[model samples]
Target: MFKFQLNAITAVKALVWTAVRRMEVKDVPTPTPQPGWVLMRVRYVGVCGSDVGGFLGKNELRRPPLIMGHEFTGVVEEVGPGVSKDLIGRLFAVNPIIGCGHCRYCRSGLKNLCLMRKIIGIDYPGAYAEYVAVPADNLYPVSDPVRGALAEPLATSMRAVRLSGAGLGDSVLVIGAGPVGALAVKLLSIGGVKDVTVIDINRNRLEWAGRWGASSTLSVTGDEALKSLRETHPEGFDAVIDAVGSEDTRGLAINAVRRGGRVIFVGLHDNEVTIPGNLIVRSEIEIKGSFSYTDEDFLKAVRVLESGLLDPREGWVDIRPLERGQETFEELAGTETKYVKVMFNPGG
Candidate 1:
């Protein structure tokens, strides 16, 4: 397949003088799977907020001339030596994180926190292509390609709720209405949290939240958000999830949670944020930071999604062809749209 031309949307670096940023499709040679790896015929890929950030050069961890897509579904088209051939025709949702198995975190099943972790699309090539190679261990079989593309983000939401420890009848506040935040709200509701409030500056997103599982939706910005929160839940929520992760949202999470309540930071929109040390110390509030998902969380996400607990097809997700990745990324970064999430069909 060396002469076979395959197309990929790759983030190419412009000269230092130019402001141009965003990936473009290029015709490249199809990759052959190495030992322990399999080549996947890319089906669907999700455009994450971080993918937008990376395209805009906002994520310091991602370098240009990369293929930036972690959430994707595909069919195994070829298997390398030592791998089973039966996987060649099966569909899968690819887990993008490849952890060094010897790390302490990996041994504890917290591979998300592995010290020597390499993420697909960021550290290596990813599925924003006609075909890409991934380790066989990272692929999980699934039935639907669209829903399969959501496994990574759903696993992230699952990790956030697990870290928050919000229980039955607990009052929870989700601080964003984007895909992850919306999924958090839905999962919390499925976990039996009744009084869930979702806040965002976008009215359309807030509406989506309400439809998903939130009992209340607040469309507020800056200080007004805190005021609205106080007015609605005078005593504050039992747990606050900061899914936007801006300085303002961090502050809101700190002040909006009841004394002794938990606060989970799930968003990485901002590089750094300041919080009131005195408030956290005095209230004895528990503040936790959640990263990506563990293997267990990823598995649970697949099961929950398969059970139809939360379906992205119900109108929360939008699909576009992979060729439009640059335009879609620009649109998503340039302005806030009604779409809570957007997925790209790479096979098209």
Candidate 2:
């Protein structure tokens, strides 16, 4: 068993989201796990793009006075009633989605589609603190905290790639070149895709995408990039993933995909976008929205992390202490920031 000093601790430090564009470190009462739940000592918690949206007051699903974080990894510190003590000291990556067990979606292991689902960080208290209590079933054993923290985002990327139906020798275009887009490129490469093109306005992100298995990177934006893409690949790409769910990217994904090709929408940047419905009908282009991963996908992500197929310490990742949450959020909210992914060590 791992020896921890948590037993004597009654209060823990947490980064609380007080209002729009504001987060402060405060001492909060340590959570007591309910039956079938476990209290975990949070080690690493990733600041997702959605969390940035929450910080910018753009995400409607997130409200102020909430603990906003969904990607995290920790060690089991204490187990509640009916839980096994064997889980103590074990490192784990959390499946943040919680669903009603009796729902049809949950019964089929598609908890992401459950209508009454509650996410850890969004719905309940999250791991933006030194301790978090989550259901025992949501814990997946992991060896490394950093890699474990990546499992959630990787699962999202995996779901998008899987839904795109891109396979060996396929030509795929990934938009945004952000964390999810970069991860999609890596997955496509690992799945034997022949050509993976990543496009982004940020040249730095495009460069990182190239290193992350993108066959080519395009540092272009708006209609100019679209025209260039059309001129270069007149036949259009076999698959196009819109990882930046803005109006322009959505339209570009629709226009850039080949006839009958698949287009996967993975980003949540914009809720509403207008695309050419007539063109979609004429080309028979299949369009699908990829949401959070299913239980199976999350498990596969953990296994992939364990296999060392994805490196957690890539140049795109920035690690900081929890006290730096405000500055980190501000930096990420800015357009000129170079940080692609930031993870916080709450216990530091």
Candidate 3:
């Protein structure tokens, strides 16, 4: 039998040369699956703020020339032997982190901290391309109406929610109304938390947060918002979620958390914020940092998406074409765009 082999496949890719390099798009190799791997036809990919910062070279969190996307969704195109062939043609959300299953973090079910962790778009090839080969372990199938690519960030919001210990009927002060924070508000409401408040300098984000379940949205340019917070939570907030990751937001979290309350830091701020450690010790305030989500988080995210609980089109996401990655990111870096979440539909 004469067999025909495919030569080259074209995919739009975001390539960042060392930090501060202009992103370029290029056609790359079509990946073939290895054992335990599945090939996906890239459908949608979300550009992250980290991708921008890394593009700026200020932090240079990712190595150069790698595809830059972690939040993505696709359909299984092919699977290697020993893999579940039934998964082909099924929609799936990509779990970017690859962990060793035997390590302390992995053993403890905290694979996000696995010593050998390889995050997609960071240490490994990523989904910002037409065809991506990933470990079958990293794929999660989705049913009808299928989950949008934005579900990844929704999962991240839930992760922060769990980390913050925000419970039903609890009061939460989210110190950033960005996509993740805004989604956090949605998750909080769905989780049955009462009286959710969102703070963001961006007026548009604040408005969006309100639509996403924020009981109160405040723009903290002065002390007026602080006064409002004081009146709302006379004692202090039950939980403070620092989603901005800025030094100012960190301080705000510390100040807003009630004695014995919990403060969860979910943002990736560049600088450090100084807080009264003695007061933290005296007040018994629990300050914790939430990293990325775990497998369980991904599963919960799948359930949430599958349930149609979150509708990104309902004021949470901005979808664009994959080829516009560069321009889109540049626009996002600007304060005027008023975007909460941006996802790329590569296949579109």
TM-score of each: 0.92, 0.95, 0.89
Clashing pairs in 1: none
Pitting candidate 2 against candidate 3, the one with the higher lDDT is: 2
Residue pairs with colliding backbones in model 3 are: none
User: How would you encode candidate 2's per-residue C-alpha lDDT over 157-273 as one tens digit per residue?
Assistant: 999999999998788999987778888988998888968888987777777788878887787777888888887688899999998788899999999999999999998877777
Misplaced by over 4 Å in model 2 are 1-8
Of 2 and 3, the candidate ahead on TM-score is: 2
Model 1 CA lDDT for position 340: 86
Candidate 2: residue 159 Cα off by (Å): 0.7
Q: Which candidate number has the best lDDT? A: 2
RMSD of each: 3.8, 3.4, 3.9
Ranking by TM-score: 2, 1, 3
Better of 1 and 2 by lDDT: 2
Instruction: Write model 3 residue lDDT over 1-348, tens digit each, in one string.
Output: 111124344433443333364666676656677788887888878777677667766444576766777888888988976898999988888888899899999999899989888887787667777777788988877763225576678778889998888787789999877778888998898778878988887888888888778888887643576678898898889999987676667877887889999999888755456777887999999999888898999888888888888676664577777667778767766665566887777666
Task: List, residue by residue over 159-204, the lDDT tens digit for candidate 1.
Answer: 9998999999799999988878988988888788989999887887
Model 3: residue 313 alpha-carbon error in angstroms? 2.7
